[model samples]
Target: MADITDAEHHIVAASYHLMKALQTTKLMSSDVRGILEKLDFHLSTVVKINEDEPDGDSIRELEKSVVSSHETITSLHLSYSKVWASGPEVILEYLEAVGEVQRSIEALEGMPLSRMSNGVLEQAKTTLHMAMERLQNELIHILVQNKQCFEHEYPVFEVYPIYEESVISNEDDSVEDASLKGRSSSETEDCAMDLIHPDVVPQIKSIADTMFAAGYAQEFCLPFTAFWKDVLAEYSMILYVEQLSIEDVKRMEWKHLNSRIRKWRVAMTRIIGVYLGSAKRLFDQVLGEYDQVSIACLIEASRGPLFCLLNFGQAVLIGPHEPEWLFCLLDMYEVLADLVPDLDTLFSQETESLIRIDFHELLSQLGESVRVILKELGNRIATCTSTTPFQNGGIHPLTKYVANYILCFAEYEDTLPLLLQDQEPVRESGDEEQNMDGEADPNPACALAMYLQSLTSILEAALDEKSSLYRDSSLKHIFLMNNFHYTVEKIKNSKISPYFGDDWIRKHYVKLRQHAMYYQRTTWSSLLTFLHDDGKVGKATLKARCQHFNTAFEDLYKSQTRWVVPDPQLREDVRILASKTVIQPYRNFVRKISDSIGEKHIKYTEQELGVYIMDLLEGSSKSLSHSRKR
Candidate 1:
């Protein structure tokens, strides 16, 4: 039994040792597998890294290409640093060399800098930088050399007819013809002169493209913009655009200022519409691929001169408001308004939006200034008064001035409405009554019309006030008649007639007639009372009436001879009306008193009275005095 137990223990110990051996072998195999898997992963990663890197031979070839391009660029830059002065063939070679260098630099940038020796990479960059610098200088030189000069002493602006005669056959002619004919000569077409010489534009574009591709756009623009700005300044000088400050404009005398303002209008139109337009075309041609850069350069180059032009307008805006400035201000407003679309198109780039905003702000300011000046003109007309009566009871100077002034406004009818669009129409005292039955016309032209009507009404009111200056009621009526008649005739004959309308003309005509009637009643109605036969039953009373009538008629003739009527038709009408009022009655008085008071008692006969009345209102006091002597 002891021997069997020893055998079982030995078997158990052997089994335990076998299990420990198996466990140790399994652990060793697992460690070896993990190490092999890690090695495989590292191998794959190394392969991928190697795949991404250029081969040694490829790197050497790229290096050779870079070295060759660098040598070529260096040679070209040294040879053609003043490429603008070189021939086309040399320029082409230089541009080709620059292009080759640009491609090499791009390739070098794509590869790892570690692959290229630091020296090679630095040399390539330096060569490209120097080449771009030369190219920039060349571009500026080309632009300056190729700039076209104004050939004419005065800038000649051509105006083409808006409507083609082919479009307007006699059969198709209608009210449209009138409107088309009414277009101002100022509504002109653009005649863009070449700002840059046509021969060198492609060369400039090539240099610009190369510099832009080389990441030297800023360097390219710097010199290009600087040179062109001076060119534009010279062009402005040629256009007679003086860079006057606001204070300088303010200090100028009006006569000199007026001439300058005229020149300014012509210069601004030429600069913005023609010269700037040509510049824009040049930029579009040269930098067509880089629109933003082109626009930025244009704005930078032109902003100074453009602002100088606007400064003149600003000076005019803040200057003293004078009635005479209206036409020039209107001209400025029209030109600015017309250029808005051009400005919107030229400065459409996001980088150039500020310039567009400035132009629009100036336009708004100009429009506002125009409105204020118009209001000032109306105020001037309204407040222009004289304490003393105008001599001779003839048409007052204010009447003639206001009449002719408003007549001039009709020529600007198309432009005035645009400037006055936001303004409320000025109304006279009775305009409300006149327009109460009808809705106001919303047409823009009507706005100007309403304002013009108000001016006429103000003129009439001023004349009414001036009439009171005459001490004699008859003379007062005569003065009102003369002024109103003159005003009516002026309106009736001018383009201003359409603004006031037929009703306005008729209303004023009736007012003038009322004044004429009033004059007759005041001057002659009292004399008519002397002709009435009250039964006094005495030759003495009859002779007394005859004598009174004779003396009063002669006195009326003498006093009225100096009162002048400027219109021939109006003078004839007044004389005929005066004859109808007084001639017949005096004839009856003379016939009745002829038997009682003979020719001796009667100082004048009907025929003689007729001759004197025919001479009324002729403005010839000497002729009437000579007739009285005869």
Candidate 2:
């Protein structure tokens, strides 16, 4: 050290300052090591110290270090995070700061910490514990913000289709258009979830993985739970919007809602599955009840979107709809069934029980819906028969409607047995006839058989009603014959007859023949009675009988023009049978009094009368005089 200039003095002072700084750094390192060693010592022997032992000072000293370390970490996190900035860099720095505090606790934890007393270790562990919590909270905030941004940018919320009066009609064109319109809306929503933020799920999983590595599996549960809550909330919100936007489901065409529900179910499964399937362990932990109430909130929150499915179920069960509604519902349930594994893989026994209850309820609702549709089909059958009574010999329009409805019944054949479990087996007079004739083989008991039985009952009742419309016994018999004949023919022509059995066909056919025979006996036998001529009768009396015959035939023919005998063969048979009854007797009588009838200006020659009668079978009546020789 020579006597130096100002620059040399400044250099000497600067060197001293550098040396002091190095000494201070060394002291700081020693202090850090001493703190770490003390932490390890406390962890190692704290539990071995009996509460009766007089070592309060060491325990207090350790507690103070833990508190101070916790405060330092809190302060550091606040200082860095106070900038309120965002992005991967900011997130990484925050994670690093939290991880630094966690590493200290992990060092202490490695030193036989199981022997540590709960009171002392709990205090020392608080720093890392709180840091993990803060880290989790920060990550959750980031996740929520990310989700909010995704929602804002993509707006994937479901938009419920509106049904103005224009689409509500039951007209063929309107229903078809409404169906297509509904499917289009569903397709639009199908893509609604396709555009989610790419970073959302992965970022959450990354944070969860970090938390798990820090021995904070429970801490990981919180943020991931929050993440899933946000995800599910979004899903529920979309469903809510969709449910609200749905028009009167009970009254409007269901095709649109049906399609919308199917699409929504698929979207729900896909979106929820995307998360649950991706991070199996994370959700499994979140779903676990490590503590009694730890996961109750998550379980309850998970059920939010499921309510929409239940709502659709409610609509399906209670609404006045057809079995087609049930078909769509089953499709939706299938989607839900596929979705269950994603969530169910995580379920605890208690949670599984809860979900099982919900499923049981849903299944019960489905069963109820099936029953309702079956009942409605029965009611519709009654309505059809009541309103469109068999008119004219053409099959009742109701019969056609019932036939088509039976065909509709075929759609639910798979499910109908379940519905009918609570119902009485359908029995009908036609079915009984089949059993009596040994044609009622035990075909596998099925919905088709039950439906046909019910339909046969309805048709039999309608035929009875139609037969009552005519006052003349013979006409009544003919009306029954026509309706029965038409019904049997339709059954034979359609796919439904096998359900009724061949003997059912034979029974109705036999009844139709009986009716025809009865009509001949009741309506035409009187004309046959007149053929029993006593030779003792005078010309005046015979002429009287001829006039009487002409009057009766004219009355009968005129009154029958309105009657419908739809079967040409049956009409021809009746006409020919009547012709034989009238013409042969008249011809014999004419032979007996040929000159007398020809001489007296009889109203119709036998040949002209026969031609006039032929017109009756053709549903037209030419006046007997129109057939008179011109």
Candidate 3:
């Protein structure tokens, strides 16, 4: 026991030390076990040395001697984690150190350790291989077992599409090649995540259809949600393929798509006996169901195939999107168009014409009913927020928008009516015989947009708390700031207004924006002063001051994007405006500022302010964008 200084002495003696530790209530060295009162500094050093080494016989022998050392270590880690969690830098460093040791074990095992110089070395190598293999298997098992956990968490994305990477719009071949210049492995790994590959839609569809025919039960809704996990897992190898980029999803084979569309098209023409499939007697119930279904349809319409329908229905109807579902939506409109006559048919002529009544009012009443649902949604957000936001994580923004709307505004039952309609094809007065086109009733999307802006403005004005959200705040601080704005926005926009003007929501948005900007500029100056000078806060704290404002701006981007009723893309243009105007240049500013943070770069305020303006315009920051395109 001559001072376990040599590597072999520390490793070999660890086994006996563990054996001694297991026999006593308190851990003790083998020789000192009989003397009940002394500290075992030698034993602690041995264990520390063991934890750092590649997995080997010495560590396992020590672990086996100690009945519950693994559990004890976990407990110790947990007890101290709050302190480590507070400092992300330390936590990351700790994980990295642990990971490096594990990586070394893996590399050692891969070599011809079977032919190591000594019997102990060969045994240690074999033991390490077994441990690594077991760990990998355990990870796979856990992921498979918890497949439904992800679904339950991200239900909003059940029908929408998810892109693994941001779509790279860069078409320059020179930049594409040169972009790999002077980049580190970590940067390359990050870039690898952005590549999107074409989906095997035809194969998935064929397999699903065959499986269903072979009596396989459908466990989930939507093709993507059901198959996405395994699909993503299997294709994960694509992430490791250097220089090979998986591109965006390409169009499905027209041969397969057209056959299916043609089948549905014929069925629809024959099945379309009435206006809304079969909503003759219970028009009210049918309308309600339609509202739910359309909302679901809109969820689909926001991504993948549905995105094409909403965005490019006229151009690629026969091939990618097809005209049938579009026709179905159109026919659903006809059913509503028939509502006026159907009411007359059911009752006497004196009954209030469901036709002459304002469509907006009917839709507004429906929207009001849906608003009551938001309370439950808010509670859920409060509960599972770390894992899932108000809208689930990885879910499409529009999907979350729909879920949050339903959750928060449960009372405002019918929002879809404000979005869709069916009316008589009225042409030039005398020649109203063939072509069917009518004037826009009120443009509910316009109204929804207005309400979102107004609501966001209200939050900005009330909270006039931060100058920039991302810089000065932790995610927790940013979340608090964002949540405050969220509550105000949901309250204002999700519910309908009593004021009966056509553009009431629009007016609300305008007023809210004006008041918000004024209040933010006026109040934030004082807040900056309060946070900066009085408390002697660090640069990080000062940087956090900007987080609230960044959050507000994100909410603003979401509001403006989702506000447009019939034309959601019109709102999407605002994102383009936000990017071109604020983000790109400020991002460059952040790179410079971030470099000089600890060593007194440019002023923290300038960087904080710049980052705030930039982050707001770019993120999926608000609760969820509803009333607009995804």
Candidate 4:
């Protein structure tokens, strides 16, 4: 074996200098020169090891030097002042490692005398094998440490980039030509609604400069790239697309706030970009990628503003206080629905996707997160655990917007199609962009409106005028229990999502917001009944509260038409309620109760609190019977 000191010398020296390089941000000529000199030292040693027989000594030296070079390169990469600063340098280091082995092989076996020997072949094979292994380890380190670089899928949502005629031909043109021609008109319109401006380049560079100058990047390269790559500038493209879409809105000069609608669509694009990443690629087919031309078209259309066409539609269709916004929102929903199925498939099936959390475990986590955040937000809004409906800012802003949009858009369900095709024409794609504005382009029905109506049915039950469960404490609890079942079923369904996604969908948002109305309504009703001081109300109301709690279980069990099997405890608890109390006089009273006017404001809250209780209780008889048979 090689002397331990030699290996330590290589490793310790590299580590120490890397620490120094990472600590210093002022890459004065001297600093740059010093790091360059250290880089040369590691490169020289690695190259020398590759040329040698790679006995234990040489192998150790190679490993140590490679480790140090990797460290230094990684540190420098973290502090990249511009795009060129990091990615290019990393590629260079990779090239250097590869080149060292190639150079060593060439040097040792160039001549005829050297090439013909079996001894040389054997030694060369061993050396190359060792070198490749080291290289593999290095590559693995880079990928694991910097997986965030590839984390976002926004960039990959476009069509394929390149293809051959024998493979992905699009009828008339060669694959290359066809791909080059790029995205469909409506597709480009979607893309344009998402592009970022080149103008932000200078500002991004400036921030990089400050970080590089401050040693922030060197100290934390992974986080540095993450902050810039994932957070700060990632949505720049979306903003650019928004601006471009506005330009289209200006060109069209349509009536009734078409420009404003464009703005909202642009905002929507940013929201998607925040979750999905900037890389756009085509769906993987059995043969090869089919997104080539479409991918480019997506990027180009997104080059202006995101969803400009939606904005145009909105401007044309919706007027303030008019019923048309519902229709326009439905159109947007249709487009969005077209985009969701593939995304759902990707999360459910793709190995590297972020949506790979276990649902039950995730739901558990969401429960805890929502409690903490909603309470905190509740505090901010001057509310509490016992506060009644219409509190806590009336749904978090994003949720409010999405839900209200869905609710309003429900009216246009008839106008939308049951199924939507993914491809849509953009106004840009050269002459075709203008041509799409013409009446000749097929104006298809939206898919969003239909989905929204189904969603509306669930909420409508909470808000309906004649519903007995809307205000009755017992009714409210049971309805919320049913709602929880409904929501869980939605989570399991093929369409729509309970969350936006892994990185962005805080566990708190789902539990706190989705269940907020139910939680508020039920909790307030339960508490008020416990503490109500009306003189004549006495035991009658209190006993009814208890029976209502039990009947709430029955209501929840009935709601299980949506579930494959209602959670078992729900039935057991209902059975327990049957044994403990006889509600001879109250059954008719329970039947007579009507809907609460305040239900709409507190729907999610009541549902939240009720679901929690159901989780704690036993299931109805049907659920127990089914379970026992199973």
Candidate 5:
């Protein structure tokens, strides 16, 4: 019995030394296992001693049970120490060690010892729970370090040039071979990926997965929300197309913009897939601020392109060049409609309404801009009603701009009808127009056609107002002729023929011809009547008539020389008509007057008279007076 007591004392002594060793030095996993084995043996020895002394004093048994409880607590402390040494990478093994500690506490509680072991069991459970919390915090610390990756501002928006293989000078050069030709060297420069790189989404997703696996999924939410919000804010600033001035837009190149938009759409789609897709929807369980942040990101992705178009439209309205932005906006819209589906699918109804509302607003603003410019031009035209000659011939100075605007409208001939479709009345059944794929469009109403028609009216009214600016009746007719001819030529040369229709153009052309005929018939008819009826007058009166004819011709020639006829064909026709009007009558007058006066009272001969008439119609009055020797 004494030897048995000594063995128990030695067991207690060895466990004490083991606990001291664990407290002093950092022990390896194997060393911890060995220490735990030694502690386990001591605990069993106490329990065995308590069992063997069942007939002894109850106080001795209680003492043995107390010694066994202390050894069990020491084993738990040793396991937790290993947790700190191994760190978060070994978190799974650490959890298993914690489970082992829990089972040991239960075993100790179930033992037939004194009720005081209950206090030790409870204390063990409390300590293990606190240790687990510490380990979780360590895991969170590791993830927080990873979160620093998103601290810097990345370029979320950028433009790059899209290059295609150049046309080879030699027909024999293959596409691949031609691609090898360089500006100054023989090496080719192939198109590379975007400088921002496309792997950003994958990198973020990989980190998120790793964090979830480390049991820090919930803890990751705060940092992720903060980081992503920063990303969105940064992206918003970089791609803020609305902040651009007219000069900035003037510097924009469409191909580069198109290329950047394409790549950006791709990136946006990928981010949506990562954050909202079914497989790893990291934001599904996140509520409150995180959820709002996630939704904000989606909204920005869907609305960013439209905002770009809006800003571009505004810039176009402010600048002299308006057509290019509209053209590029339409192209980008078409490309996105075909390429991107997630934006439509995610916010189907909202996207439709937003697109239509935004587009209509853009059209309304553009129409107003067109109206203002045309109105200003009309005011200028009203003020130009004077005898002064215009700088650009008979045509209005604004004709070039108006023609270009009309042609711009014509470029969207196919698109206009679709955008201007009549809005069907809302039914209780809620039926709507379906696209080719049989999906009903959410917003089907557009007034772009009416807006375009209004712009056309403004343009037409401005042109008509300009035509009335000429004071001379003949010059007014010439102004109308030149303007109508210009309109007809622009329509014929461009796709704008559709807007005016064939009949409208044909009718305007007829009006133009009638104006030309009126100027020819009425302009010189009274002048030609004087040279007629030479038989009714005496020789002296006929000589006076010849002198009056010379003075009238010079006055007419000097004034009409400054009156411009821009079109070559029309100018020739006017000259020919003028010749027909006066040439025959004047030649007859010269003959009759020469015969009647017999070159005695006549101030000019028939040959010199013929040359004067030629000069009058040919618009070269400088040499008319010098033709006396002829």
Candidate 6:
């Protein structure tokens, strides 16, 4: 056992020494790796330095190029003051000099500035700066000299000829003509306005390229943006877009304000669609090498006028929510909606996203305003009341106002759906299926239809309340019948008929007929009872009944003749219906009673009664006393 323990201790000691030796070796290996990596890095740096060292020939060539470019820039700077006055060849030489300096600067960029001797690098930079300054001045001069005169009388709504089929059918036109013909009016307008003359674009682009190469993009943008901004402002003034605040709009009378709103529509369309679009094209043409810079330039230059137009819409949005303003709001909404695509295309860059967002928010606010105005109209109609009823049971003012208002909405059928799209339609009981047509989500048109239906229903309820002001029940029915008939007929004849649907018209027509029937029953039924016999056998009784009939008939004729049914067709229909109801029964009773009581007891022949019934609703008062054959 002692020998076995001794061997175990010896094995443990050997293993411990071996593990210590292995760890020492690993540390030594790590030190060698660190040394090797340092050696490799130093060797690579030496090789890179040797490789970057310029040869004598290349250095001489760079120096020569710099000297030549400097000479060109210095010579061009002498003529800078008269750059525009000089011929095109001088302008061309100046642009070439600017380009040569830019290229020399680019070639020097690869060399270490410290390597150049005798201030060569500094001299080159100074020469390039002077060249860029000259180029900048030349660019401004060319832009100013070539800018197209602002034509104040430019047509606001000119339809381009290429959009017409006559222009499209010409086979001799170029590819550009075909492309122009294919473009929509808005797209055509995008390129229609030229800020600078076509001859100057190439010269401007050359200067722009030189400036951009020399890292003077900001300097290039400044004058271009300023010139276009002033032009856009002038264009705004020409379009009659006044710089009015919300307070200004609020204070103006509606007549003057209406004119301004119309001008705003034209101005917004022209500025955004034409001027901004043209400016974007100019930037792309001049600074096509730098997209971000060009887009930034456009946004900065036109931000003022663009937002000026948008702020007008915002001002109108915050103005009063009167019923009369509804159409104007719709007009603004439509114009904005139409321009959204153009705005998206023009302002799609990240820098111009804020303008896009502002427009979207304005569009949303205008839509909300329209909804508020429409809801207020409904509220006004619902609460509309009168202490005095219409004198002759003609169509009520409320009905006329609402019918005309709803018909106007039909004119905006294409635009209202987008505004009303987010609203959950108010579904009266049993209208859900009709409105949704078995779909869970109703289309925008359905929502608009539902809204119109609700409005008309509110108007009907208002008319119903107003009808109670009439003291006579027959005139109340006449009032409702006339109003309902008028509303239905107006809807039936106008463009809004589809939104109300055939079912709605048919149902209202039924209601109108019911009111007519009510008028007949209430007015003529009582008078009809006089003609009926109650089993009286004596001739005196018959003669007394005949005299009572004549007196009641004459009184009814006098009072109701003055009442009106303004619609001629409706008037004829009402008369014919009364004739069928009262005239035949009246003729029979008069004929039967006249045989027993003699001709003197019967005051009116059936022919005379027919004539009187025909004149019942003619809106005139007449007396039969003079014409009575006593």
Better of 3 and 6 by TM-score: 6
| Model 6 Cα shift for residue 607 (angstroms) | 2.7
The regions of model 5 sitting more than 4 angstroms off are: 1-210, 213-215, 218-342, 345-393, 414-469, 588-594, 597-630
Query: Over all chains combined, what TM-score does candidate 1 have?
Result: 0.78
Ranking by lDDT: 6, 1, 2, 5, 4, 3
**Residue 509 lDDT (model 6):** 90
| Steric collisions counted per model | 0, 0, 44, 79, 0, 0
RMSD after Cα superposition, model 2 = 12.1
Clash-forming residue pairs, model 2: none
Every model's TM-score: 0.78, 0.54, 0.20, 0.24, 0.50, 0.79
lDDT of each: 0.70, 0.55, 0.31, 0.35, 0.48, 0.73
Return model 1's CA RMSD, one decimal: 19.2
Model 3 residue 79 lDDT score: 44
| Worst lDDT 10-window in candidate 3 | 175-184
What value does the lDDT take at residue 57 in candidate 5? 46
Q: What is candidate 3's lDDT per residue for 351-405, written digit by digit as tens?
A: 3433223322332332233332222222322222122222211122222332243
lDDT of 1 at 607: 81
> How high is the lDDT of residue 530 in model 2?
54
TM-score of candidate 5 to 2 decimals: 0.50
Candidate 1 residue 374 C-alpha distance from true site, Å: 3.0
How good is model 6 by TM-score? 0.79
Which candidate, 5 or 6, has the higher TM-score? 6
Deviation in Å, model 6, residue 12 alpha carbon: 93
Q: Residue by residue across 372-406, what tens digits does model 4's lDDT show?
A: 33223213222211223211111112222224333
Global local distance difference test of model 6: 0.73
Over all chains combined, what TM-score does candidate 2 have?
0.54
